[model samples]
Target chain A: MTTPLMIEARGVEKWYPNGFQALRGADLSVHQGEVVVIMGPSGSGKSTFIRTFNGLEDFQKGSIVVDGITLSDDVRQIDAIRREVGMVFQQFNLFPHLTVLENVALAPVLVRRRPKAEVQQQALELLDRVGIQHQAHKYPGQLSGGQQQRVAIARSLCMEPRIMLFDEPTSALDPEMVQEVLAVMQELARDGMTMVVVSHEVRFARQVASRVALMADGQVVEVAPPEQFFTAPGHERSRQFLSQIG
Target chain B: MSASPNLSHPQRTASPPRLHRLRRELFASPLDGLITIALVASLAAAATGFLHWATTQARWAVIQANSNLFAIGRYPIEQQWRLWLLVTLLAAATGLSWGLLRAWPRADRRGSAWPPNDTIAAALLTAISFYVPLALHAQAGIQMRWWAITALLLLVRAAAGRWGPLVPRQLRPLLALLWPVLYLIGMVLISGGLGLMPVPPAEWGGLLLTLVEASFAILLCFPLGVLLALGRRSALPLLRWGSVVYIEFIRGAPLITLLFLGQNILGFLLPGGLAPDRVWRAAWVLTFFAAAYVAEAVRSGLAALPPGQLEAARSLGLNLPQSLMHVVLPQALRVALPATVGQFITLLQDTTLLSLIGLLDLLGVARTVMANPAFLGRNAEVYLVLAILFWCCCAALGLGSRALEHRLNPNTVALNTSAHKA
Candidate 1:
């Protein structure tokens, strides 16, 4: 059975003013409930491509349709796209001044103008879902790397986003802590949440991903099912990346 | 001590005795000891001579006699209660506002800072603060009034500490309305026409005029500075250029030149009998000058912020205004605290320049007191008193800003790591 497309991007191109090309004709697509993991060497532009989906990074040339909101120069459209999309950063970019519950509840209450009590209740439930309900009152600094990343995931889930983007969320975690973040993501995928994750976690990609896409030198080099991609990646760059990371 | 755990932290130890450490650090070598002893002897000799002169020789009676003039200038003595009332209101306000922020970071050197909760300590500070005026034999009214303001400040602080942060979102409009409430109060206090005798702006002088000018300038200048900073960072060319031009133009001119223009030239610009008072004129000049420097300081703070703050706020679906209010400015203001506080202190001192235009602020009153034949030949006493007043006010502002900085951001606030993937 074919699933409906949740995201479709075509010929995405971006360049810095200083003349460094960060993305060159990168294309990405995700179907509803698909867990697509993009892996690449550093500077391969996988993170930049993911950021473009929500209009955080402007593209010089591209068409991205996420949840039917096209990325464009229009402010209202971009804001709509951002609301429908939730992003988790590698740094776990939680607001330091606010408590974990506030971090989760802030975007919905402030952006969506939802009822405070309702948003807070939902946030508490999200925290529990992420396995950090006990840390609802604690600030981000008080949490370990794994717990903080989990809180970030819950914060995104609080928005009830149609598409979730993870920009190397576990890249900043301790080796021992990486498993906990991946476990949460695995649970999220099991719930059929459409997610695009840019991470170097090979085991997570192999186990949880619907497809593993390899990017090299600012372009998508190959896209294949996880089992096939892990065993037989098409591109020379993908083989090199796999060997180097191993 | 016998079976300590393998902890990561260093072991604590009792510090060396002060005398032993001092001798080792300062008197280790014979030449070092000889030089240290000589330096100490010279400092003690100078301090003793200064104390002797201060205690007996200086005629502090000049300041004593003109204490009322120093406190409220030429305003009627009976009506001085209005100024005293203003002080009480402002002190209470300071306490309430101070209570809104959370406690200061634990890393502060003085331990727990002077928050509103520390009312007894505030009362003690108030009592101690009055000693300068009391030691010089100021009127009991002025001294008592100072203590009253300080005590009230502490009381309001405690009250605010209890319930200010607890003010629910529905009552936020009440808090928002406070700015207008304060404006109305200030206007009534200064102009005094609501069933009270009107004190002309010309009669406003001494600490009254200094505090009024600096406070209004600080209050008005901060919003203006924030606007200019936002405008300078705005994407629109018109707003950015307008802010840039205004900031550059005001910063180019000396504050004295701006004051001169406010006093001498602004009157010509206004229609006959419609000109604002010199006090208002000086206020405008000070506000404009301060806003420019404050804008620069705030811009530096904005620059210091990592780009991720904006990105994060934007990604969270916050528009520009919401992004700025909820995320960017909160952090930027903490970064801008010291520089903005520095500008405020400078503006306080620069209020002295208002005296050049015949506005009788603290310095102006001191000058007038010196000019009087009765107080002639005692310039030292008047100037010294004025210096002390200015120094105390500036110090208070610096301390307040430092406490606010520690409370708002602390060292843990800035989590903007340059490395995204690491």
Candidate 2:
């Protein structure tokens, strides 16, 4: 009864200017402290759907209400929404000029106008949490892919965001390095943060995510508890995707 | 598929038979050897003549003695120290700026350190300090004020360098603004603001005029260039068009034409009677010319900034102006700084063209002195010194630009290192 529904999306659709409809009508609902994983083949609108939640990508027709704020075309609201929804990209967009500590501290200092001392302390703590505290003074270029991804996570967490979104966070890493980033993510999920992850790492989804949502051709083909979804997917498209990706 | 017997034989590890090859290359034939020898002899003769003229036979001692003649023009011998002090102040400022920017936090131990360019700077400053005092011995007693002014300038520079970091971010912008104030003070002091001191524009000659023209133009034009660049990219159509017209129209013509227009037509254009100061008008015209070029450089800087930077700043909730000053402009101006400095150097060299309009700058003074009966046939000597002075100025600007470019883009250095090793 106390489960708080943090995000609700109904009939989300995106028709880009060039007449490519990247997303079809899709409905999703996520609860507080729940991990949801979205898996799909390439060009299935998995990334596009997640990007819309943070307002990085706007949809043409949809109703998305996150944390009680409704999505609108108003740019101001988009910024406000972005502040609460922390996103980590496949390519860690850490500012090259800034050291790891500075990169983590930037949003807090610039966005929240936090005191420098407080922000620096929080930045270091987040870096420690991500297991890159020792490399705080080094730039993103100096770090390994795994370390950079961890720093990116730390940077997002520095905002103290309400919800975390990971868009193929480990996809760019080498096979050996991918586990380190996934392990950090696994720790975040265990800590009971609300998270929506778009990833192909099926083992990660099976172990952590409460529900697995399978998307195909811009539509959610299946949504079921991971145990049932993987073992007995209802839809033929979901069954085929699992066979291919697994 | 069988190997040939000669090829299958193990190669002997031995030197080939040493042929007594002639040292001469293709010049073995009689006609070629004669032509090569003649060419070598002619080159040697020319080299010897150049060395003798450039070093041994040059009248450097007399030129050194009358250096003030080339440094500051026919200004009263008594006021020569003022010009010397100004040069020393500028040199000290150059040194201080170099030191401040090159200084890094003590924490960065693993980072590569720049070679001590500051020592070269210090040596240059010392040379100026020594030369100024030695050259102005006649007026050294009474012109202690000049030395005091130089010391004050040095103190300001040192203070700015040392305490600059401690100044709040809000005040750092005002740091750039201080140059205009300092320029005004120097101008007033030189133009008889002090009852005891007086030097008119007509008398302001030599390298001092070059400095005056360059520094004044930079102070006036740099800000105008920024405005024009911003205006050209403005959302308002009227502003964009106006700025584009201004920049393009000025750039389309030559500097001499603008100077001529400023001298001849400016009085008629304005209702207020134009000031009778030809040098001021010329400086204004040069500043106008420079602003157009500077605008183009700044526009390129603005264009180079990533669109994400602007979006990020906006999403941080900063207003348009705040985002521009805090985020967009800072990065853009860093990209633009070296180009602006290059333009400043070009403006300095272009100041020599002021001689065409009868202003007695260093080149003007040199031409005047050469035309006199006393210094007849010394055009080569005067022009040689002028060329050396101009070369030094241009070289400093070039080096400074390279250093700044290296700092801004260390990836270039990294790429070069990898290329060199490979």
Candidate 3:
């Protein structure tokens, strides 16, 4: 992987319309093909932090440069960044009206203006890779939570994105279904896709992530390689978060 | 047979026959027995009465062409066929198409909870009972166009089932756009423009003209309403305020007054010699008034969409127009379809108000029938027919919305049914 840094964020701050500061001076950087896991307690801005990478969440004062394009009020550039960075929601917002195959193929056909046959073929292949090819014709509502999450992953991947962000993709899954979704993510990570995952799945982070960053109080308290971050942490907040979630 | 599978097990006890179960259910309580008995007796009596009217006691209604005046005004007798055929075809085709789309399945037989079967049966019986009066009092002619339109509706329904296979998805927008375009062409040609086979605006009366005017109003109102909705939600203050004032003012007053204003007030706005035909003026006024109400309905749909949908589209690299067109409008229209149909029914009924401005719509023509010396007291009969026509149409539209809502809510049904069973 010879590509340079895919994302860089500095001094990112967001104050919601209701005066809640979701992200306060959050800073992060992601190099090409790097897997960064963001772990934190609930409402600690970890999900918001990852969402900013794809412009799903906007910040009040920050500079986010993704894939060499700057993020601002200019609609054009933000769209460009979003095309390169795909964010999967915790809710797995697949269109309920469409089949799993159509859901994956929709953005490719509509937004990317790809040929129908080519997109459909690629979507089928992605579904196969996610181990849900047989369920392609069925709707999301007809599938289990884990199966829907896998379809969501394949949908994001259909855009042929350079970076993927997962915001607790397994949080909504049944206990028995969690491993099925995590297995798909594990395969993607092994294939060298750059990923920023915000989850409490400590075992997934320990096995796959090159580096783990602990976020607390709308800020990244510490970032370290998996071996040290799990074994020893510098910040008291990181220690407390790990102790609670481990 | 194979050791009797434990007689104590509930499954081994033969299930009660369905008829016996029904008997128990219907006769288990005194209230149910009373209701069932009353219902059966009433139905029996009604059926006997209807049979007598249709078969034994009634004369066939036939319009007498020899003595009856053709077209009611200066219309050529040859051209009268076109209008009469157009009318019967429109009515019967509408009724038949409505029945095809929404007729319930055979097994349900729950006696239509919404429009009770009794209301339908009573209406049919009454129509049959009035055969003698109708047969003696009316006149008609041959109907080539009537058969043609009936055939066309059959073709449309037969083809609609194969719509997915026959129609390309991309062509759907054009298919939707067709009705309004054709309506515009019809209005222009019938209302006399382009110097090609012009039908004079004053001569436009009867059911054909009523349909033409009402459909034209609907066609014009939809786009105008959509534009108004967009304007009301626009960022610019001038456009927003203008839309609000337009919507509120038109909705505040009765449509009859608007027609009056169009007839009387607009003469002041235009130069004396440049004023359009009064009929055209009334058409525009009706279209504008309807557009306001339709705009509010569409706005309600727009407001119901979740903000996440817009954000999701924005994040997907869709610009404002793309987002609105692909995401926002599709969802909004799905929600707004029933309301749009409701607005159309209102517009259809409102066409009668044009009679106040001297246009001879169906209601206006019915009133003319009442003025005839022989038919002086037949006002009840004419008005009854008119009421039935309007009621049938409005009821069909309301039922269509309910069917569409249910079709869109299948998942909710499964969830609800499971919850109920639990």
Candidate 4:
């Protein structure tokens, strides 16, 4: 339990301009190589909470520290934090204009200013790891949804971040194609990559998640290991959530 | 294996013959046939009369006599060689750029055949257009030889296309560098700066002046428009409101008013009665006017993008500029292409407004030519040539933009072909 902390969130709060609160006093911490899964019903702020880790979503109140860099209003700090944290969204937001290889190779070459040849080689290897190396030349639109998601993963992996965040990554995917994306995530987890995933995939949670955090009403309600969380629920809401899903 | 009919070999539904299709479309009902016949008769009658007038009655001597004035305005006759040299350089640069652009690996891989047939056709059409005009009017000796040399320079583009791959990858950036250098050279040659005899902007006229104005306006306004659009969407209120105010204020006024303001009042507005050249003032005014529209066009493009694209870019550690340059603008600009090109064509036509303020642009030159007592009532001939010139330029802009849209959206092209097959 004494591994280095990769992410630390304290009392994170966010509100839309219409005064609807999305994240309220949310707090969580993840150690290096730990896999944390945030699960909740629709509109429970699980997605909102995870998005804050990478500075993709701004919080009106609260502080998030990723890999020792604190997230603030300073763009430079946000950029630095984002450099160490990778995120995957439900929509798979791959750049449709660029080829799959270019998608993976772009950030490293652009943001990191890495040598193109070296970054491309690393990109091709990452694409291979995700089992879409053959689709490297194709645009994102040309690939299957599953393949596009894998390329998105490869694109994130190419940055070689200290932490990875997945916000309902498989929610938009077709049921038949879900397993392929999950398999890549599972492989990623096994490689000891610190990940914070917000998904309803119970099987993925059971298999790879080190801790499952239940969120409701813009806050994290419970955090426990999957074995304990699934078997015996301390909170009444957790039991209610489990039974409803079943 | 069970005996079954192969679905792949299903009977094809052959389309009806072209003649039958045409007959059904045009003559389906008695009313349709009657309407079609009436329309065709009127069109043919009008066209025939127009053709007869154009061939026999139209006096083209005004256009012939004033071709130089139309092309270069009052640009000195001795300094005309500079114009010819500029044309030769332009021809070579355009040819080489086109070749190198087509030779670029990403553009090449998008399945267009090398030396695209349509491009060749466009080139031939352009060549014939230039040839017909010059052959009909240009004084034969030096002008014809310069024409020949310009045509020969254009052939360099084809040769470069054929062998562009042999160009070293490291040296390809020089192709990009060539443009700004050429632009500077053109400025120097035309305006006669840096050790050459200076030509005042007042002396600059005709198509040359119109082109210079339009080019400066278009080039300057694009980046300004992009910045303004970004500013309108900025997180900071000051930047956002400032952009909104500027865009609205400029958009509210008509361009002619802006030009007039530039011509008469702009000099006084400057400190110490410092007046810029009329051409500069007109160009700046046009740039400001066009920029507002371009900003709106680009804003629409920015609006159409999903927020997820920006989020993903930021999540990748790309700063705002990097994200915009690499991801956001490329897609947004593609979406904005048609509208932006439309604005550019409008701006180009808007240059004729320069004539209203005493600048002798293409349209102005035509008016001056018509004013000549020798060519006193050749309005039809003069106006028709002017219309043709404007039409050619606008049509080329439209066609070029479409080609660019196609090249940018390779995925769309692939999807279209697949859809067509389906």
Question: Which structure among the candidates has the greatest lDDT?
Answer: 4
Better of 1 and 3 by DockQ: 1
- Which residue pairs come into collision in candidate 4? none
lDDT of 2 by residue, B50-153 (tens): 78886776655435545666776667877765655655555556544544453332232222223345446545655665565565463565345445544555
iRMS, all models: 2.8, 3.7, 4.0, 1.3
Q: Candidate 2 at A11: error in angstroms?
A: 4.4
Compute the lDDT of residue B47 as modeled in candidate 3. 93
lDDT of each: 0.83, 0.77, 0.73, 0.87
Q: Candidate 3 — which residues are off by over 4 angstroms?
A: A1-3, B1-28, B31-78, B81-185, B192-196, B230-245, B264-275, B396-422
lDDT of 1 by residue, A1-246 (tens): 298888999988999788899999998889999999999999999999999999888889878898987888999999999988989999887876667888898889999999999999999998998899897877787789999999989988888889899999998998999998899999999999999999998899999999999998889999999998888888898889888987
Q: Give the per-residue lDDT digits (tens) of candidate 4, residues A5-112.
A: 998999999998899999889999999999999988889999888888877778999888889988888889988888888999999999988888999999999999
TM-scores for all candidates: the values are 0.87, 0.75, 0.78, 0.93
**Each model's DockQ score:** 0.37, 0.16, 0.30, 0.74
Which residue pairs does candidate 3 place in steric collision? none
Q: Which candidate do you rate higher for lDDT, 2 or 4?
A: 4
Q: Could you tell me the lDDT of residue A55 within candidate 3? A: 77
Ranking 2 against 3 by TM-score, winner: 3
DockQ rank, highest first? 4, 1, 3, 2
Candidate 1: residue A48 lDDT (0-100):
90
Whose lDDT is higher: candidate 1's or candidate 2's? 1
Give the true-structure RMSD of model 2: 7.9
